[model samples]
Target: MDEERNGTGTHLSDAQLFALAAPAAGEPEALPAHLSLCRDCARALREWKAAVGAVGEADAGELARRSPEEWRAREDETLEAIRKAGSHRHSIPAWRWALAAAASLVVAVLVLTARRTAPPVAAVAAHATPAVAASSDMSAADAADDRLLRDASYLAGGGDVDSGSGLESRL
Candidate 1:
């Protein structure tokens, strides 16, 4: 690829043609010596320059066709937008901070009150059903599996199988 690009015999690549067509701002690129000798590359560069010029001219023509009123409205809208952007508040309002602090305090108070009012774990466990009490002696995995199976069975409308209650009684 390097040889193909640098070879004086070969035509300029599309990228090289574009660079020649639109040189970088404040930085002029030296034209390849081959471009002067190669009519095909020179013509391609001219075509690229024409295309780039057409793109810029198209937008200018569109703007030129706009009515004076439309131009003024567009200018006003742009200025208003710039003004609003510049005037944007960077700091939060005092009321917002106060409200947030109050909200946090309320939530903390509610959490603490709930904790105080709730029954202790031992008391709750004491009131649990025989199955729940029995699970206390089982391994964690076994207990989790047991709970899942119980939930599934309950959801399926099948009451506890070990409760001595027949399906007829449940129905």
Candidate 2:
């Protein structure tokens, strides 16, 4: 009986007692001998087995008595609970789609405006060439070109003809 201790404690945990109560064939040798000599462990194991059997019987009876309608209702309740607990919403709202479209239109209008206002690649490259000297005629020509480009961009952007620096104001 002393040999059954295996140099560890005399008592067993609930899991160890449960394993001993329902063991597979030809498991470790020492547990049965220990249970026989230990009155406390033997009594605990008996109680554990009885409790497990009673729970199993109750579960079997409950399952046997369940009707199809009751099962469906239970399943629906479980599914509803799962839906409520889920993180994702159903779908994006209409306002979000409208905002996105408005944002896209703003971006497109900005890109078109930028393209229209930007100097042509050829004109930029022309300026890269060294000039002989600063000339008043060249400066005047550059100013006229700038004013034309600005007027063209303002008109293309749908500036009101009846208002703002129109032909009447220029005249």
Candidate 3:
């Protein structure tokens, strides 16, 4: 930034120049053109841009100075820091992993044991008779339907059913 005085020396701070540039850079109006027209503001903008680049370079150089082992250590530290920053961000605990692995192993063993020790399904099937019946319309009302009552004598006599009350009563 240039703080000019008529035949007198003056100066401007980097902060002031940066402040002036920040607003114009964000604006969508003629302020940007006005910013360029002021050589001091333009120079100040370049200087700020360069300063940022320099800081980034310094950071990169510092990171590059670490040995591979040190780099790994730094990476691990960063990961751990990030993990610690949020309690939920870290990995599962070793004990939890072990428990899960043990559970899986036990499950596998039980499955294998069950496959071998359990009785064969086909053996059970061969001995079991089907329990479901198809039809169930037999009732006294159906049997005593007046139109069919003419056959009541024969029905009461009974061929398939032994009970003297006859088929419907036996059922």
lDDT of 3 at 49: 64
lDDT score at residue 67, model 2, on the 0-100 scale = 91
- Model 2 bad stretches (over 4 Å): 1-49, 54-81, 84-89, 92-104, 131-171
Ranking by TM-score: 1, 2, 3
Question: What does candidate 2's lDDT look like per residue over 1-171, in tens digits?
Answer: 232434434767777776766665747335667676777777787887787777777889878678999999999999998887662453446667889999999999999999999998888768744332333336776755555555666778987657554544543
Of 1 and 3, which scores higher on lDDT? 1
Rank ordering of all candidates by lDDT, starting from the highest: 1, 2, 3
Per-residue accuracy of model 3 over 113-165 as CA lDDT, tens digit each: 99999778987665442311211444657545532443465665654334353
TM-score of 3: 0.26
Task: State the weakest 10-residue window (summed lDDT) of model 1.
Answer: 162-171
Decoy 1 TM-score against native:
0.32
Alpha carbon lDDT of each predicted model: 0.76, 0.69, 0.60
Model 2, residue 54: displacement in angstroms? 4.2
